[model samples]
Target: MPRNTLIAGGVLVVLGVISYVASAFASVTALIPAFLGVVLVICGLIARKKPMLGVHVALVVALLGLVGTFMNVLKIGEVFAGTAERPLAVVVSAITFVLLLIYIALGVRSFVAARRWKKADAISQA
Candidate 1:
């Protein structure tokens, strides 16, 4: 329920909507971001009461984003190799990559906060 987690979730939801719109013109594969966005929103909402769960969900999403971005980067050459080039595809890909990085940052931050909270609770109880 930290402010940053809420902001991050909101950002992800917006980005997902943008990705869905972009997918209309690009490729069906673009749906990945939309899906991730939904998951992030759900996690964020749940995180308000159960931050540990949210942190775990965010970490999983971040891992997925990392893998997806890596694959996209590797396939960039193949995507542009054809003469019938599509600039929009490249732009979408770049945007996705950036969003993924943001997701990772948010996930890491939430995770660290959750860990600290656990440690503090243990110390207080002890």
Candidate 2:
């Protein structure tokens, strides 16, 4: 899970850099993904020492990202229709939303697996 988080963070960071560069550095907002990615990366690193807490932190951050970019889901329609005022921004936001959603799902799956593993280990010990 930590490895996956790191990979996701790297992807998000690259996305932010590409978007910012494409905008000619005119929009600071383009770096939002980068900021979020940095936090995720930190969380990933922390997970190496404290898996539970670090995963929780990373999941929370991802949830926030998903909520923040949720509106872009609607804007995606405009993008497809060629009516979006800022199509690229909308696309970027939608991409972020999807990525966060996937990350959250992965986190949940990891939690479930951990729970099962713990339960099994407890049963064996008993």
Q: State the lDDT of candidate 1 residue by residue for 1-126, as single tens digits.
A: 444555655665676667667667456555655666667777777777887787577667757766766755555666567632554555455566777677677667756887899999999999
Against the hidden reference, what TM-scores do the models get?
Answer: 0.64, 0.97
* Weakest ten-residue segment in model 1 by summed lDDT: 83-92
Write down the TM-score for model 2.
0.97
Candidate 1 clash pair list: none
Q: Local distance difference test, per candidate?
A: 0.65, 0.90
CA RMSD of each candidate after superposition:
3.9, 0.8
Q: What ranges in model 1 sit over 4 Å off?
A: 1-5, 22-27, 75-86, 113-126
The residue-by-residue lDDT of candidate 2 on 1-126, one tens digit each, is 988888889889998898899888989998888889999999999988898888899999999999998887778989889999888789889888889999999999999999999999999999
- Displacement of the residue 42 alpha carbon in candidate 1, Å: 0.3
Evaluated with lDDT, which candidate comes out highest?
2
Off by over 4 Å in 2: none
